[model samples]
Target: MEIFRNKKTFTDYIERQKEMGKRIGFAPTMGALHQGHLSLYEAAQKENDLVISSIFVNPTQFNNPDDLEKYPHDTNRDLKLLENTGIVNAVYLPEVADLYPAGLKSKAYNFDGLENEMEGKSRPGHFDGVGTVVEELLRQVKPDNAYFGEKDFQQLAIIEKLVQQLKLPVKIHGVEIYREDNGLAMSSRNERLNAVQRDAGKVIHETLVKVNDWFRIITIAEINKRVKDIFDDQRGMTLEYFEIADEQTLKQTDFFYKDKNYRAFIVVNVGEVRLIDNMHLD
Candidate 1:
């Protein structure tokens, strides 16, 4: 697959593809590719004539500098994987200056009420960085469709809001969250976990599964307590937040209504890496 590091070159190529009447699909990612990322690429390939994937470790999105520093990267391996997929037309690997030549003067984004809970509350200014980088990428690529994983469910909601607010032409698609056989949600951050911590991380998903089962008969408060109790009992796992909320608005609700869709979202620190996962309750 062709790799373009220059923004102008990539956009110019996209323009040429436009002239050929080819529909484009885009998937933006930080390196460290995995099966979850490839699933997005595969989904894009099924619907679009051309598919483009980007790998830039966006500094603007990290609230903690150390987390940014600890984030994984391996360009050679990533490129090889993309090539193996044989569906990716090109990969955009832009330098920091390429995307933000004037430095990060982030614009404020109003995601309605979606940005004020869970991830928003824990990591201040995190979504702003997400909004800024994602906005810039979408502006640069301007693809007909973009793919994002449901693993970062709130971030996906915010991006959808951003597209609506900006009225961008691109269709934002949320692919289902990919997981390991044991149910640990796949993430680039998973690389940091030691063997023991990797096994312990399974508890995060296990708790979500248990919570989904209890939703039919239990009160919301009881559900919350049960989730907490599971993490409390597990060593090396710290529950950040767990809530059952409307799948669309992501606003935590007191009780699950029979007709509305609901999902359970959870975040935990296994070792020093933070992992987030969500499960839909029909």
Candidate 2:
């Protein structure tokens, strides 16, 4: 895989590819590469002539300093993983200066109230950071297609809104969430969880599955209470927020509407590591 640590060279390469009539696909990540990330690459490769990616753990997205400090980082392993796929033609490994040349700040965006949803409500200024780095990367790459994992369903919605507000000519694709054999959503943060905590994390997916089964059969209120009770019983897991919301707008709904599709979003604090997962409440 071609590696780029500089902006101008990266853009020049992308321009050359575009001039050759290549359709580019892009996926921006925070570097601790996993199968979930590669899955996006595979999806991109199927439709685009070339696929590119960026790996920069953006600092502005983190509300907790410790979370930032504790984020998983493994450059060698990440690079190796990307290389193994042979689908990624280039990967941008930018320093803070390379991405944020203007002294590190997120551009102000009102993702049309998408900025105030679940993850947004839980962590302040999170989407601003997400929007900033994403906008920066998308501008530089200018790909025809972009891919994101559905594991962060809310963030995916926010990014779709960001792309719209910016009026960028790119299609955003949300690939299905990748999971461990036990159904826990795959994440870099999973690296921090001990074996015990990892096993405990299974409860998250289990609960999501139960909610899926209970979705329209029971009242929303009872389902909410049942979800809470399940997590409340787990020893090391803390239920952060669980919402069954409109599938498209991401607006949390108290009751399932007859005309709208719904999805269940949940965040669980497993010990110190925060885990997020969502299931379509079909």
Candidate 3:
């Protein structure tokens, strides 16, 4: 796949594609590619004539500077993997300046109620940074469709809402979360976990699995307690939040949800790496 690091070159390439009447599909990612990310690439290839993926580790999204500094990067390996995928047409490896030029004021994008809980509440301004960078990338690519993983379920919901609210010409599609054989959800952060931490991390997924019950309706606090109990059983792991909420609205539920659609999610710290996982409450 062709690689363009500068904005002008990437835009020109897109211009040529537009002239050829090719439908564009884009996947935005911070480097450290994995099977979960490649799955999005596969979905994009299936539905669009041209597929573009961006590999920039966005700085503004991190509330913790240390987390930003420690985030994984290996562009050479990532490029090789993308090339092998046979699905990515071009990879946009833009510098931070290319996306955010000097003296360009920061733009604010928030989902009101949805932005204040779970990951957002824990890491303030996290989604604003996510929205800012995603808006910039979506505007730059101007794709007919964009693919995101359900692993970042809340972020996917937020992006969908942004596209609808702004009338962007892109359709957002979500790929299901890819998991390891032992059930730990695949994530770039998984690379940072030590052996014990990685083993303990499975508890996050298992807690959700054990707690999910009664598709019709069940008390949210009861489910929340069930998840917290599982986390409590695992030492050295701190529970950040356990929630069951409307998938689209993301508002936490206390009473039983009569509506059949929602999600069970958790964010817990296994050592310094914060892992988030969710299972659809069917």
Candidate 4:
């Protein structure tokens, strides 16, 4: 697979591919490659003539400096994993300087009401950073299609909005979340968890599953109480927020609307790693 660290070379290569009438599919990632990331590459491979994946741990997205510093990285291993997939045609590995040659600039994005809840409220400037980097990458690659996992369901919604607002000629596709055998959602942060913490993390998924099963029969307040009770009972897991929200707008709903689809979103701190997961509650 071809590796590019410079933006001009990467853009030139992409342009050449476009000239050849190739339909390019892109997967933008923050490295720490795992089965979850490879799944995105697999999905992209099926639909496009050529696939490109980028690994740039964007600093702009992190509201906490310590969280950014502690974020995982292993370039050699990431490339090996991508090579093993044999689906990625090229890999874009850019330094912070490469992405922000002019240095960082503050930016803002309006996601309608989607950005006002959950992660946005928790992380402050997180979605703005996400919007900035994703917009830049989409511009640089200019692919026909871009793939993102539904694991970050809210972020996926924001990206869809970003594409619409910017009038970019790319289609955004959200793949289903990849999970571990025990039902915990696969995440790069899972690397930081010890065996005990890893097992404890399963409670997050279990709680979501319980909510999914009972959401139809119970009131939203009872659902919230049940979820809190589960977290309180767990030794190592600390619940951040659990909400039943309209899937489209991501605004918390007090009652399940018969006309709208809903989802349960959860965040938990297992040891030092913060994990997020969502389940569709139909």
Q: Pick the candidate with the highest lDDT.
A: 2
Q: Could you tell me the TM-score of candidate 3?
A: 0.95
Q: Tell me the tens digit of each residue's lDDT in model 3 across 51-119.
A: 999999988888788988899889999999999988899999888788787643456775766777678
Of candidate 4, the 10-residue stretch with the lowest lDDT total is 97-106
Q: Which stretches of candidate 1 lie over 4 Å from their true place?
A: none
Of 2 and 4, the candidate ahead on lDDT is 2
lDDT of 3 at 157: 90
Clashing pairs in 4: none
lDDT of 2: 0.91
List per-prediction Cα lDDT, in the order shown.
0.89, 0.91, 0.85, 0.90
- Model 2 reaches what TM-score against the true structure? 0.98
Decoy 4 TM-score against native: 0.98
Clashes of each: 0, 0, 0, 0
In model 4, the Cα lDDT at residue 211 comes to 87
- For all predicted structures, in order, the TM-scores are 0.97, 0.98, 0.95, 0.98
Ranked by TM-score, the better of candidates 1 and 3 is: 1
- Where does model 3 exceed 4 Å of error? 102-105, 214-218
RMSD of 3: 1.6
Candidate 2 residue-wise lDDT, 90-195, digit = tens: 9998889877899788778898888888888878899999998998899999999999999988889899988887799999999999999899999999998999
